[model samples]
Target: MQNLPTSWSTPVGALTATGIGGVAMAVAALAVTADPAGRFLIGLAALGLLVVTALGLRQRPRLAIRDGNRGIVLQRLGGRLDVDRTELRRVRIVRYPRLGRRVPMLEIDVRPPGADDDRLLVFGRWDLGTDPTNVFDALNARGLVPPDPHRTPDR
Candidate 1:
């Protein structure tokens, strides 16, 4: 299937947070319908409020990340994320046990200067994860990213 657009910001995230929060609230509300104790409903509403507030406070990003048939791209919006498939140098996993799961991330090297090239990139769900233009599969489709000898790795 085709992927969703890659570039994203925090407002979408806020909406999603609110949606989940709403669902939780709805279920909780229903659960407490016959409650003689108001504690349960209070707790549920508190949970929903927390989610809503958190989403509201998130920062909106100007930078957009995307994966194309060529490679993963990371640049300011309207600029390119995947210069080409070959631009995607590596796909690494950013591990955080506190987080629910391990997610694959793209380490794109669109420009060269090799090792000195420190353009850190990360993708996968947070709200933007559902996007069709992703970094991993796009670069992998073309095979490994070839080293650009014309460019040098940073010392």
Candidate 2:
């Protein structure tokens, strides 16, 4: 399967900030006090922050979705979330209520073999290298996305 291009600004920025903040806090703790217990607690907190930030950076949200041979992969910062083809149920474009207006977003609803409820994966336009419409069209062409019964013909 061909890999889709992706964008990674928002998540990268977040990761960068978290990493810098974590390190700064750790350094500040060392400089602030010489007491063992206080320094220990601060060190622990800083370590926790750094660890969480590192993990998040590895799987940051700004991603790309690529069609795999047997499933679709949500390509993240340094990892990929692979959803089996069988798990995928529907793909549609929806409007999100943001900043008092509706913004277009792609929503993929999936239900794994034994799951009771659907899991939703949402992606913004920036996530895809191209337009969401183009991605949708390509997926639809490959029979990955079923037509929306409620959608009007003009749409």
Candidate 3:
């Protein structure tokens, strides 16, 4: 098997390029379009794209598994969340239908040392720029998360 990366992150270059394209499209639509309704719809779409790009940029390096299997790091808008190996309670991949296709997500349950409650962190394909199943396999290969007996091997 091929070696897996220790970290997974959104493609910043792609996000930046998308944001720039949205701006260009919005500007072009406003300049070239004579119909008010058409310009409005195009502008709205561009705005949505920009918003998505901004959110993606805010959470750079979405997930990272520390070297030597020590811990995992999650980057968020407010700050970073670090979960040590001991704190990781469970890790699994969930699949659900979205827009007529199945989407996979990685969910990690962690309990901070001395914390009374556990936290669930979920990462989607957009966040990881890859399939959650691949991340699950990588984590399993690293022994960070054990194999799930209940999970089918079809993936």
**In model 1, which regions exceed 4 Å deviation?**
1-68, 75-82, 99-116, 130-139, 142-155
lDDT of 3 by residue, 55-131 (tens): 88887789988877888888888889887888887888888889998888898889998889889888988789888
lDDT of 3: 0.83
Q: How far is candidate 2 from the true structure (C-alpha RMSD, Å)?
A: 5.8
Per-model TM-score on C-alpha atoms = 0.37, 0.53, 0.80
lDDT string, candidate 1, 82-132, tens digits: 444444554443434446864443344444435456455555444344432
By lDDT, the candidates rank as: 3, 2, 1
* Candidate 2 C-alpha lDDT tens digits along 9-73: 23456567778888988997898776888888888888888986776655544443443435566
How far is 144's C-alpha from truth in model 1 (Å)?
A: 6.2
TM-score of 2: 0.53
lDDT of 3 at 112: 90
Candidate 1 local lDDT, residue 9: 45
Ranking by TM-score: 3, 2, 1
